[model samples]
Target: MTLPSAMTFLLGGLLLAGSVLSKENPAELAVPRDTTGKSQWVANHYKRMMALADKSPEKFRIVFVGDSITKKWLDDSGSLWADNFGSEDSPFYALNLGVPGDRTDHVLYRLKAKEDGGLGNLDNPAIQPEVIVLMIGTNNLFPPHDAEQIAGGIGAVAKRLKDLRPDSKLIICSVIPSNSAQKDEELVIPANATLSALAESMGDDVRYLDLFSPFLDGQGKKNTECYEDGLHLNEKGYEVWFSELMPMLKETLGLATEN
Candidate 1:
């Protein structure tokens, strides 16, 4: 499914334009109020992703879907991306389908292709991913939504992803501990527990990755060293994430352990 050189150039141009616009007003690039009627920035981002999926010569074997944490892998932690997935010769081609400030509902909305949302186009046999790494639900804990609502939202996302790409292995990550949410155990703890349980109940296709302990201290407080703010991962945090993630990715995808 390689694209012609001219088409590739045109796609690059379109992507650059979208990127420029997204950068101008980053807030508008997050999940839209109406997934079916995505903002211009969101639409551009989705369209660019679809174009890349359609034209890339390599198969998209690994996909990371989440909010800012996942997006940071491409932006702040780009060097890590190069270190892990930069090899053009490698069989694994990864895509980051993260929108900043996305909640579980937003993710579910994005996965709904019938309504012209999600990356559902990749469900086409040609570009379907071999693995989809999902880390969401944290944003839902902000206010109003309780643990049950957040968990339910995530459950819906997992179900939808399964339905959309049944053959792909789904890795559901626990919402990492945050500075602000650390003391609010009633909300954070229960939400993560629910997510873990959801993964366990989903059978072999879904695996839960708990990154909480690694990012927390013995007192169950967020390790300030790992985060730039209370929420977002710093470079050191990303290092921890990549270290933990690589092993899981290898095991799930049956890739060689020797890196």
Candidate 2:
């Protein structure tokens, strides 16, 4: 395919085949970020996960990838994480590869091959997933990005994830509800709908999980009871999420095993 002289390629440290970059979704282009506090956090967490994977790579069964919400599965979820996710004798050990303020492109940068400047966990055999869950896209809900664009970004990430781990069952989760006035149901609802369709179009091994449904109240608002601030989840919120996720995880594991 020949390109126009005006067009430029998305080069460097990004997995293009499994990327979130295109003309329409250019805002979500995958690129490594090194902002001050965020850079420190990303480096620290990446190192921690690498160390854990190096020590007992085989113990990693479930890998949840996303931003702060997924990262806090270990922090805010507290004992819930300890007891259910990775205690001495839990059903499965998990890797929390969530980075705060991550967009789809950022995740793609991280998921890129080590030779490509990414952490390359996907390329690591021992750190592969039995069931991998991708819960991102919320961070990309800013100006000029609509629901379709966000969903497209997530779809790109899902494709990248499966390409890296074809043997693993992939779960693409909808952006959970938050109290951000900007990221209200107007945006989240349609984005999730598009993601649902995207999952089905991807075929049998890939599926979509909705995090928006259970995290709501009778009032159809962000259940303040489930939120830490306006966005991130508190302990109560994780409980709400874990209830749905646990069943899905078990079922996904069984299906993955059968395969």
For every candidate in turn, the CA RMSD to the true structure comes to 15.7, 6.7
Off by over 4 Å in 2: 1-22, 35-38, 142-144, 255-259
Taken over the whole model, the C-alpha lDDT of each candidate is 0.74, 0.80
**Measured by TM-score, how close is model 2 to the native structure?**
0.84
Off by over 4 Å in 1: 1-40, 114-123, 182-184
C-alpha lDDT of residue 224 in model 1: 86
TM-score of every model versus the real structure: 0.78, 0.84
For 160-247, candidate 2 gives per-residue lDDT tens digits of 9889888989989888885674576677888899999989998898888888888879977778899989889999999998887877
221 Cα displacement, candidate 1 (Å): 1.1
Q: Report the lDDT tens digits of candidate 1 across residue range 1-259.
A: 4579889999999999999875442211224444355455666666766665566624678878888898788777748886666455555568777777778766765666644754464455665778899988777766536666667777788887788788989998888886566434766678778888888898897998888888976786788888888889989999988877878888899988876
The whole-model C-alpha lDDT of candidate 1 against the native structure comes to 0.74
- The candidate maximizing TM-score is 2
Best by lDDT: 2
lDDT of 2 at 187: 78
